[model samples]
Target chain A: MSTTGGAGSTALVTGASYGIGADIARALAARGHDLVLVARSAGPLGRLAAALETEYGITARPLTADLSTEAGLEAAAGAGLGLSFERTAWEEERRMLALNVVAPSRLVHAALPGMLGRGRGRILNVSSVAATAPVWLGTSYGASKAYALALTESLARTRRVRRSPVALTALVLGHTVSEFHERAGIPPSPPSLTLGSPYVAERAVRAILRRRPPVVCVPSVRYRVLAGLLGHLPHRIAALPPLADDFTVTSYGAPQPSYGTGEPPAGGPESAGGDGQDGVLPAEAHGQRERQP
Target chain B: MSTTGGAGSTALVTGASYGIGADIARALAARGHDLVLVARSAGPLGRLAAALETEYGITARPLTADLSTEAGLEAAAGAGLGLSFERTAWEEERRMLALNVVAPSRLVHAALPGMLGRGRGRILNVSSVAATAPVWLGTSYGASKAYALALTESLARTRRVRRSPVALTALVLGHTVSEFHERAGIPPSPPSLTLGSPYVAERAVRAILRRRPPVVCVPSVRYRVLAGLLGHLPHRIAALPPLADDFTVTSYGAPQPSYGTGEPPAGGPESAGGDGQDGVLPAEAHGQRERQP
Candidate 1:
């Protein structure tokens, strides 16, 4: 929570087995935080925690929990992120809601009181540019992020939290190099459109540690400009048929026939667990994991 | 869903036993649309349905359902609206989410395909200024509405929905004279800040029936202006302690100390179901209700 990096504070990073969450865990550990690393994959989480503990000489606990379920939520929970760029089934959408909305919400609700009482804490929620974009191709994903962004902003602006030292930030992330797209069946964006997890994580941590942390944080300059335009442009112009069509094809792959129907994808919810814009590693990343701090 | 109001088409209204929902049902009925009214109180819903049928010569079917429970959601669903302006318990917050977020989402998800397939329909979601406002006193209410607003906007802008005839509108209502405040235990706003249900309902229906319905609708001119301002203002200025304090006192009454704690209010969720911004009548309004076009 302090500007001097993690110090004696403990940082909990969910979806920490891979990608941005793992990088963030590394960043926080380097800054001297005791870590609780959470992800559905126990092996990766355990390895990440042990590596962080050894490298940073700080305590690191690995917790495996699928935050989409009630019991999972009760066990541990953020970096709650997932998105099906194409229209997915209601069940998948519900799972996305549980991860992207309910999990973070429950975590924040649970954490806020103690943070307020201590008067020294920081809660950073990883959101997406979808939260700000005027035009979105899919259902529920943007809505979920909007919930996260609004929740963080609303709580940050409240009299009690604002007066106190608790810094609440919603990192409105754009495309980052992660397994999210592959896992969700979304075609990956061009390399130019993506940011590295290391850089994004650093900026995210910095945003939360600021004197007056921003309610909405967009990591890179380009994405910040894009987010600004997307947020303010009139819907008519933003959703221009050609522009929207191009975005649809480029970002979401192709329009699936099963969109309107509530048909489950081949693997269902279990297969698509890597964090969306916020970062989570795919199962394969565990074998070839690289740890650099 | 049609520009001509009712005809042979059916419009489903949730929380229809009271306030805005009842008024809207009346408006739709007068316009000649058959109605499916959903609410928790069977008595009030039945009465409203019968009266609408008698007066408008339109089919009015009342279905009693809470919409905050799985059973309730399965039975019927909005007009999803409710808010505890003062910070309430987590249980209350969860209920608010169920009513405001889950209910509308389920309804829209259930209805969209049929509407799209038919190539004609309208879905109006009741949101609030809180969805756009930077400063909020409560935890989940504004966040929930933000989800509603984002969902509406996102879906409306999607290629399939855009090309189709279905109109999706999120009504960003301002202060209205209803039993919502009393039920939620928040003091009422000044009469000047409040708009009546009849006027609001008429405007809401008009918005949905338009050739190109707005993604977001604020009925009153003054509120439209206010919504514009609130949506754009910087957080530093918006959350200026004194300004926010005045707003908190005027809009939400005094701050409650039990905010952080998940303490159940005296009456719990059962007592407070009057729609916050979109309108729902208290139990008393049921007995002394006046039917007007």
Candidate 2:
């Protein structure tokens, strides 16, 4: 694969219906990438694909598969026709593993050969700060993120040996104003305390462009320091009842639902069509979404 | 459920065939605690139990069961027929979670009531230094240990709130002279470079008694410092080419046989009785049969 610096690359983003994933999709498209957006909801993906295609002139394909299942991942990987676990009892757990671990692994694996053949590519995994935190409230979510972090690290490490320009970047995000909080069942913080979607999107894109291995707690240096310090502290000190209580309250008050039912806000950029002949939208169209006033 | 200080108590240890697990069992026994030793192979468990009972005058029991599967953990958790994997998985996961994220939690849960009632108790989890390091190579093992570290921290945090004298300690260990290397298909380094079994056993016992939470690296303080450094470094730098090469070589060099095998050296500890009381063969005799010269 020949590595090109930029402007003609293809990017595939999962969980791209909305929130950080949507923002990432937009950012990559703006930077001239052909996009494949994956999520369970078809409504948002279609909206996103259309917006990207019209606005940025990039090909944006929407794949509405529940990515947390083996079959879903296998299909996404283009491995073969596989059975879906839609009727399985352990569907929830299996889906989470498949989406968070297996799908990403397979997608990266599948995309790597092509990326390598082209000589340059970037895989930006939108991971959460929960990966490093020891809070138990979001156990599965945190563990899966940890797996992503490790996998990304491993890929980044090994890629150097292969001399591939495939950059694996994990964005360790904190609370951003997105559907994630709503899906998680947690109320959004006051406007001053919350992060905006546009800013997060911009930073994520920059990290990928710059090939940062991992970004911990974007826009807040203090939180990053705190996470690092907390991770290193003695288990006894960290486990102190008062501290644990404080941490649980501060870092994990409640789970927020990450999905929302909605259409993209109207008057946004048009959905772009197939391939290279498309024209780029003006950068000013990337406006911030309104949240709790 | 009542915790008496180290004055008198009992602990049941699984996977006590050899290596760190066995050393942990011995360490607890040496502290005048009664012991229940469990392993799939009855031979070493019996022998180790016998030696501990004979030397320390502490009662020792041996029961064989594989811990990774439900049937095994169920037997060890006691034959209460009402056990459900749903509740039991949570409970066991909570306990071994530190073994994986939940062991320290369960220990604190179990030890707190007793420790609070008597105003003192101690629980030590034999964790690896790998808990903090990136698991680029030893993925499952490192992930499990990370869970251990998290649970330990969670419990330690809980201690401060309850004002309980239940001390939770995590002995973050490095490479040592043990069968773990052999089982994991790791070749032993030079004698001076490894922590002798006796040394680790004694140090672990002392740390537990003192309620110290130490990130330990056997034989070299350098390894602890190195681990600390690696844990904080950005994912990219930590996964740099040379480091990745070194890690991959060391971690995946020799393939390990599956976890359990019943065979033991002829006329050695593996031939000992199941009860543990009558298997106190001399250390020299056991060593000659088990260790390669």
Candidate 3:
């Protein structure tokens, strides 16, 4: 490791209460970075913070905040993680947009100048393979991820960042074993296709600490190959009905009336369902039904 | 022409007050489609509506509204158009997200179900080459367009749209002749590289009216070739210093305090700077300063 932060470096991570985010937090803490962990679940965040501080002998602060709202953006200016399922109600979709799209842009826009002034910093935005594949049709989640990936890559290419010591990397992750799927009420994926959280975290932390980290990182070798192929695949071939098990689109009944009131359905605010684990593959890879084509 | 709408098809176009959008409205009207033209500027929209009605013998309803808010989205459920420049304040970025990202998603979400029900509707989202080539570093405009492009393609691949007659096409436009640059105080581009609005509109109208239009449309032949090459260009090659005129990133002074109040800067609302013409090439292509690389 280049030890970009060395010992006293402070790192802020969002969705750090569980799954990939939690593992990443642990990895950063072990590297001797003071940590600010942000997530909506207070109990888990607090517990994680305490555990990290005790285990790694470093400062760890738990910040409870909803990253989708402006107030949340103010409270935790550089924290973000989210996902969206297919066939969600308009309410869920809106929340997804705020968290997945708006939060990342706001955080980056808010953090970059200061990072430039400090002459050193690193931003690692965890995006999904959905960013390149665009296989999920029913939701805007993939599109939101495209924004994250594009923003990170574009910023990295800019003259200011190119000339400076700051680094920006978009981790285009593959599916990982995490609470993300369980929380979304999704069935588990086959063990063969899933990745472990600890492994992903190790790759992520290593990438960010590199002397000149790449603009885009796909951790596993298999996924790196897949991402490269998907990049050049024609829209027609990609749109085709993939080999039965490769990808699929399942409808969860009719889409809820997304127009009308644009209000939350009888349910109160939809749960903040998208955790950092919503990465890689299509629906089948995520354990959804086969494509009906 | 498929004549999907035949003589009385109604097309709602946002940013119809001027530039490529206005030209598109004119083309649709000439094809005998009744028009609902939405824009923030009342004068231009009204004039265009009047002229189209008189010239094409078709109904043209002028709807003046901003498309970056829920109320705006509600007022014109299918209207969308806007752009963003680099080094802008937070307020401008917010509006860019609204118009460039939110408006298209909201409009498509609001209009899709009804279109599917009708079994005959066409959605044409105007995106820029920036959607594919993220050469622009300082603004989220390209990322926003990536959202627009991804949404259109993903939706087209969905079971519902694929099985039905509803068509969605994202026009991956290159730089075109329009008032967009002038409004943002950007200098004119090399005449050789810029395209005329009429040709682009004609191409767009034709694509939407096709029996089986493509998911993406790069209007001009040269741009089509460029978009194809760019899609496959390795990030390292792309990240390298391009041949002087190919691309450049210029800093517009220091970025404003994007985090402070998140309020309008000392100035009121930043002008809705992005129009449909913020397409193709990068900073230099758009007539900005050469990159220092």
Cα lDDT for residue B262, candidate 3: 26
TM-score of each: 0.83, 0.63, 0.82
* Interface C-alpha RMSD, model 1: 3.4
Error of 3 at B210 (Å): 0.9
Can you list the residue pairs that collide in candidate 1?
A: A18-A281, B6-B33, B18-B281, B19-B280, B19-B281, B20-B279
Model 3 C-alpha lDDT per residue in residues A138-215, reported as the tens digit of each score: 467677778878877777777667778877788776666534334433444445546776787788777777778788
Sort by lDDT, best first: what order?
A: 1, 3, 2
Q: Stretches of candidate 2 above 4 Å error? A: A1-10, A41-43, A50-61, A64-120, A130-151, A158-163, A178-193, A211-293, B1-4, B40-43, B46-126, B133-144, B159-162, B178-193, B211-293
Q: Looking at candidate 2, what is the lDDT of residue B271? A: 15
All candidates: CA RMSD in angstroms?
6.6, 11.9, 8.2
Query: Could you tell me which 10 consecutive residues in candidate 1 chain A have the lowest summed lDDT?
Result: A282-291
Q: Write the per-residue lDDT of candidate 3 for residues B188-211, one digit (tens) a residue.
A: 444654677678778877777777
Measured against the true two-chain complex, the DockQ scores of the candidates, in the order shown, are 0.46, 0.10, 0.39
Off by over 4 Å in 1: A1-6, A75-87, A178-187, A241-293, B1-6, B75-87, B182-185, B241-274, B277-293
Worst 10 residues of 1 chain B by lDDT: B282-291
Q: Comparing only chain A of model 1 with the true chain A, what is the TM-score?
A: 0.80
By lDDT, the best candidate is: 1
Q: What fraction of the real A-B contacts shows up in model 1? A: 0.60
CAPRI verdict (incorrect, acceptable, medium, high) for model 2: incorrect
